[model samples]
Target: MELTLDDLGVTLSRRRVLDGISVILRPGRVTAILGPNGAGKSTLLRTAAALIAPATGTVRLGDRNVATLDPRERARRIGYLPQNAGVHWNIATSEVVALGRLPHRAPFAAPGQHDLDAVTRAMAATETAHLADRPVNELSGGERARVLLARVLAGEPDWLLADEPLAGLDPRHQFDILDRLQEVARQGRGVAIVLHDLLHAGRVADDVLLLKEGRVLTSGEAAAVMTPDNLRAAFGVEVSVQRNTGGGLVCTPIGRALATA
Candidate 1:
């Protein structure tokens, strides 16, 4: 199964945020959406998660349109974790994650064995098990981010759509989160994440879609789409693409180009 966006055109407050956006998020791999600020990266993730309706075209989950699916069915199949997802309550971390089970629970029913197991596994995957009992507000920003991610993971959805999940994280935690996300994709689920770090995108994503001004500049295999020419075209920066010690590609922006913004 796949989450496919077919020629999507979305408008917010009478202004088009995404236009002619067409991409397929296939199972078993990560697709990173890279773009500058206000390029509609988060908007695209919202569309994929069925949180926003497109003005044109359609979002399909497999052969069925997402708009036609039941709300709980959509929730059970697609997990969306927006950037800086917040917890308003002073509740325990595990409790925060348990909230993800709402879609699975019957009306007025307590969490079942499956729900509990999923929460536990999610906490463990995000390395937040130790913070199980801590109040969500007590954790640092990075730690809170992890807990929120676990909340999404607790749903065990077939597709993950995360917006800037690597933000507010240290370098090690960034790697840790990326590795975990890659592991999620390897488990035969699809992952679509918004990212600003081109290096991390190159290292972790099997495919990449680069957006500029809400339109796709280039899209394909990460290595192919992130060429120096594409970088200059998208970001107006002249960059040097090189191989690191691990043989992964690294991009370095050496100078700004005189291209019009």
Candidate 2:
């Protein structure tokens, strides 16, 4: 199923956060939302997830309006991992992950074998099986991030939306999460992530959406959209784009772009 945003606009507290934005995010590929601070990357993502209502246009999931979906149905079909997701209660790591299966369970019924298996698979995929018995409140930031991601994965949603999912992760774990996201896309699920790391966005995203001032500055295939000129326009930074031995695009900001009269 494709997640489509058409002429989308969002307003928060009487202020417009996104305007005239549109994109078709496809399944079986990763789409990275790239922008500078206050560019409304997170707002756009939340709008697509139906967590935030759009002031104009629509977010459609394969012809069905996202806002029309039942809450439980929406939770089952779309898994959202917000930036800096917190665990206030001292819940067991395993229990936190199992929460993803709540939409699938019947009212007042216990988890079945399927839920158990999904939780096991998610924890293993995230390398959090070792921390399954630990309290979520006591884990390090990176560990907690992975655990929360596992919680999202356990639901087996058709679309996975994450905002800065790699934040606080070590380089190794960052790579691990990127690989897992690609794997999810390969399994025919749509994946969209908001990323600030230009290099990571170049490497991990099949498509890139560059946002500036709450609008779509440009968007298309990663190779075409991640050019130095586009980065400069969106971020006002001069950057160098190169291909490594693996033919993956690598972006490095070299300096600030010179102002034009």
Candidate 3:
């Protein structure tokens, strides 16, 4: 199922955080949202996932408006990983990951084999299987992030929406997560991530949405939309676009673009 967002606008405490945001996220592809800090990337992703109510427009999951669907049903179709992956309690890692299955369980019922299997698969995919017995609160930032990602994956949702998922991760872990998300898309699940790493977006995202000051600068194929001029326009930084040995696009910021308030 594709995620179709149309003319989405959101206001928080009388501040317009998102305006005229619209994009299509397709299955079998990874769409990365890129922007400067406070560019409303997180707000757009949350609104698309129905975590935030839009002041105007709509978010449709296939042909169904997500806002009109039951909460549990929406949870089953969309898995959202917020910017902060902190778990306040001293909960076991496995138990924390298992939380993804809650939407599928009957009221007060014990988890069935399906739930256990999904949790196991998710933990393994995230390389968190070894930490199953450890308390989540004791893990490092990257470890906890992986565990939280596992929690979202355990649900086997049709769409995965993650905010700043690469933050705090080491280079190796960052590569792992990006590669894993690509594999997820290959499995025909739609994946969208809020990313600041332009190189990673070039490396993994099939599509791109570039935003600036709560407005979309452009959106399209990753390579085409991430031009030096567009990057400079959105980020206020001059950059050089180069090609690596693998023919992958590499973005090197040269300097800040001149502007006066």
Candidate 4:
């Protein structure tokens, strides 16, 4: 299913956060939302996930408006991993991960074999199965992040929206997670993530949406939108985008743009 944002607008404390944003996110591909801080990337993801109400326009999943869907159905289809998500409960890590199955089970029903299998796969994919017995709150920041992501993956939703998922991860773990996300997209599911590293974004994302303030600076295939001029325009940095011997893009910021009068 395509996640379509039609003229989305958001406001908080009477301040506009997103305005006139429109994008059609397709399945079977990864789209990276990139910009400097406070560019409405998180808000856009939240709106797409139906966590925040849009002040104007609509977010549609295929032909239906996301607001009109039942909460459980919505949850079953769209799995969201927010940035710095916290697990306040001191529950076992497996228990925390199993919570993703709630939308699929009856009230007060125990987890079936399907649920158990899903949780196991998710934990194993995240390499967090060994930590399953530990209390979730006791894990380090990176461990906790992976555990939370495992919870989302456990749901096996059709559309995955993640905000800055690579933050606080080591380089090895970051590459691992990126590979996992690409695998998810390759399975014909829609995957969108807010990314800060231009090189990583270019490496993983088939498409890129560059935002400045609350509006789109550019949105298209990564090769078309990730040009040096667009990076300078959106981030005020003069960057070099080159392909290495392996044919992957390597984006390096050479210097900050000179201030304009």
Candidate 5:
């Protein structure tokens, strides 16, 4: 599956949050959205996930406009993880992960064997299988994040949109989540993630989209979009972009320096 946003603009009340943003997400690749705080990255993800209606423009999933799809159908096609998701119930982690299957279930029907298989697989993949019986509210912040991620993955949606999925995770878990996303992409699913860590974005994203003030600053392959000039322009910091000895680019912000005469 693929997602294309055509001149998508979103406005709330009287404030414009996203403006003329156009981008394409293709399967078998990871696309990272990077920007400063309050740059509408979350807004874009929400629009793509059909959680919010765009004030203007269209979001096409494959050939059909997403707005035309029924809410249940859309939920089955796109899995979304919000920035700050809270679990209000004292449910077990396994039960919470099982909620992802709701989109596929018939009304008042119980989950079948296949749904149980998916839930188990998702927990195993996220390393949360051992914590399955634990109460969601009792988990640490990072543990809760992974369990939520497992819930999203259990949906088995064609498109996955995640907002700051790594926010509360430690370095090891951060890599684990990114690696899982990469595995998903390799299985030919479209994955778009809102990433705060530029270094992690460079490490995992096949394509990079940089946003500023609700506008696209630059977007393309990671190598092309992550140039020092663009980084300086978007972040206002001097950075050194170099290829790591192990391969791939490393961007080190050397700190603010006066422009040379």
Candidate 6:
């Protein structure tokens, strides 16, 4: 499914969090949202997922306004993993992952064999199957993060919105999660990820949205939007963008000396 934010504007406590933000999230591609803290990246993800209603403008999923869709129907269409999402229950990891199927199950109906199968598949994809029997509250930070990601994946949603999904993960787990998300996108699902690491975003994301001070600075292909000028503007640091010998760009911070020079 394709997602389009048409002149999207959001306000909280009379403070404008997002202003006239517009972007197209195409299927089968990964779009990374990169920005400094408080740039409204999380707000954009929440707005896109229909978690919080926009104060103005509209978020459309394939020609249908997200606000008009029923909550359950929307849940089945969009799977969102917020920043540092906590599992409130003491449920086993497998049971927690199975909760993603809630939108598909009947009210008060127990999860059937199919739901178990989906949960198993999601756990395997996230490489968290071994931890499935453990209590969610007992897992380490990274383990818990992967389990939550599996929960989101089990929904089989057409669109995925992840906020700082790589946070708390080691280098290996970070790449593993990104690979899994990329695989999901390859299956024709739209994915929007909020990333703090610009290097990782450049490596995995096909498109990029650079936000600064609650507004969009640029949006387009990663290579186009991740220029040194933009990075300096958004991060207040000098960076050198160099092409790796094997291909792709490597960003190196030049520090304050260059800025003064």
Residue-wise C-alpha lDDT for candidate 1, range 1-261, written one tens digit per residue: 888989999999999999998887788989999888888999998988888999998999999999889999899999999987889999999999999889888978999999999999999988999999999999999999999999999998899899999999999989999998999999999999998877788778888899999898888787888889898888878878887787667877788987565
The TM-score values for the models, in the order shown, are 0.95, 0.98, 0.95, 0.97, 0.96, 0.95
Q: In candidate 5, what residue range of length 10 has the lowest lDDT sum?
A: 244-253
Using TM-score as the yardstick, the better of models 1 and 2 is: 2
Judged by whole-model lDDT over C-alpha atoms, candidate 6 comes out at 0.90
Tens digits of lDDT, candidate 3, 1-261: 989989988999999988898888898999999999989999998898887999999999999999999999999999999988688789999999999999999878899999999999999888999999999889999999999999999999999999988887899988988888888899999999999978888888889999988888899887899898899889989888877787667887788988858
Quote the lDDT for 15 in model 1. Answer: 97
Which of 4 and 6 is the better model by lDDT? 4
RMSD to truth, every model: 1.7, 0.8, 1.7, 1.1, 1.4, 1.8
Separately for all candidates shown, the number of backbone clashes (residues 3 or more apart, or on different chains) is 0, 0, 0, 0, 0, 0
Deviation in Å, model 5, residue 176 alpha carbon: 0.3
Clashing pairs in 5: none
Work out candidate 5's RMSD over C-alphas. Answer: 1.4
- Per-residue lDDT tens digits for candidate 4, residues 60-87, read 9999999989999999999999999998
Residue 200's C-alpha lDDT in candidate 2?
93
Candidate 1, pairs of clashing residues: none
lDDT of each residue in 131-171, candidate 6, tens digit only: 97899999999999999999999999999999999999999
**Decoy 2 TM-score against native:** 0.98
Q: Give the Cα lDDT of each candidate.
A: 0.90, 0.96, 0.90, 0.93, 0.91, 0.90
When 5 and 6 are scored with lDDT, the better candidate is: 5
Best by TM-score: 2
Sequence-dependent TM-score of model 3 = 0.95
Pairwise TM-score winner, candidates 5 and 6 = 5
**Per-residue lDDT of model 5, residues 1-261, tens digit only:** 789999999998889999999988888899999888878999999999888899999999999999889989999999999987989998999999999999999988999999999999999989999999999999999999999999999999999999999999999999999999999999999899999877888788888899999999999898998888888877777778877775667777788755777
